[model samples]
Target: MLIDEAYKSRILRGEKTTTIRFGEYEAKPGSEVYLVITPSDTAVAKVRITNVERKKVKELTNQDAKKDGFKDVKELVKALNKIYGELHGEDEVTVIEFEVVEKFESGIPLKWLKGLNYRNPEEIAKLYIENNLKDSPDVDLIIRKVYSEGLKEAVRRYGPKRVRDALLKAYHKLYADGKI
Candidate 1:
């Protein structure tokens, strides 16, 4: 779901649970969806759709507007007009209600991690090794240890704080980039 950046704070704060769209959007109840902010296309949070309703513009009430984080029906109508042009009372619209499932501390563009092999501590260690430590003499041995023993075991065996710090940094980078 692509939401306007202006409503990011509201969504994060749990104040905006409903969104009114200009058409009959194909969203199913109980489906989980990522809420990506527009322009930047950053995935900020995950949400579960609770309901989907179709109604005419005239049917929108103050309660609906409130759920959408609007002051009143009039305010919602004006905003809708700005987004969808001149809408008549009988025009149809889709109302989507969702609940926040998880919020990302730092948002990441979804595209960056699409090609990643895995999302875990091991993957972070691998990325750190391959990208930053590839030229070191012990690189081959470290790679072998990482694959054979896994991240936790390798960290315990080596006790390399640099490697640990790198792994932590890589994990946060991937997480912020929406990989993990």
Candidate 2:
């Protein structure tokens, strides 16, 4: 779900719970989706869709506008017009209601390692090793073991504490270096 940067604060503060899209939107009820800020495409939070309703523009009310973080229907319409060009009252729109599940302190860059699939710590460690520590001794052997035995098995073989420490180190390094 792409949202304007202007609404980032509202979303994070729980002021905005519903979004009125110009046309049919794919978000389904009870589905979890990432809230990505537009233009930057930074993943800021995860949300669960609570409801979805389709309605004509003319049916939009002050309540709808309020849920969308607008002062009134007129304000909402104007903003919608600015985003989707001219819209008639007869035009259909989709209303998506959602609740924030998790918000990130530092948003994940969608382009970074393909968003690192929402940044699993172990996965980050594996990729970090592959990309930054490939020349280190035992790198190849560890990589092979991880691929063949999976992360849990690798953790057992290498000691859980060591694997956890490596994962934490990799995560912090990536975060500190702005690679996450």
Candidate 3:
């Protein structure tokens, strides 16, 4: 499960307990989910799903938004539309409730890269694969990294949602090349 910085912090701090996804989520109630902080594939914690509820976007209550670290339902809806495009109040959504079980120091530590200790992009790509993408069937580590790393400037210029779209596009390309 990927989350943005704010929600990630809230989850770590034990403030946020519920997450609202815009559509269907296949995980069972008792399944474990590795929470990865987004714009980067950094696994920060592990959580166990306690419940899953499906409802229309309009059905989200202020209480639900509060559990998600938002001030109210309106705030949650606005943020959702910004990230996932315009959504009507009646749009279907999945509400997931989870509890953190464990945390990690550095899921994908970039300190070595910052210190110029890595061999090459390919090696780093492989390292990423070993750490996070091993079980993912159609995601190319290298291509994903290319977009993620390459979009730093764009992320700074445009922001996370757009950059995330670019990264997803890159990953989709990998599927076509049979490298996923």
Q: What is the lDDT of every predicted structure here? A: 0.74, 0.76, 0.65
Cα deviation of 20, candidate 3, in Å: 1.1
- In model 2, pairs of residues that clash are none
Listed per model in order, the count of residue pairs whose N, CA or C atoms clash below 3 Å is 0, 0, 0
What digit string (tens of lDDT, one per residue) describes model 2 on residues 1-180? 899999999999999999989888777999988899988897788899999999999999999999999999999999999999999999999999999998865565555425344564345756665566442344444544554555556566886555444454555656677676
Error of 2 at 56 (Å): 0.5
How many clashes in candidate 1? Answer: 0
Which stretches of candidate 1 lie above 4 Å from their native place? 116-180
Answer with 2 or 3, whichever has the higher TM-score.
2
Task: Score residue 83 of candidate 2 by CA lDDT.
Answer: 92
TM-score of 2: 0.67
Listed per candidate, the RMSD to the true structure in angstroms reads 9.3, 10.5, 11.8
lDDT of 2 at 36: 92
Give the Cα-based TM-score of candidate 1 against the true structure.
0.66
Rate residue 172 of model 1 by lDDT: 61
Name the 10 consecutive residues with the lowest summed lDDT in model 2. Answer: 133-142
Residue lDDT tens for model 3, 131-167 = 4443243335333554355434444555555434434
Model 3 lDDT, full chain set: 0.65
Single out the weakest 10-residue window by summed lDDT for candidate 3. 112-121
Flag clash pairs in model 1: none
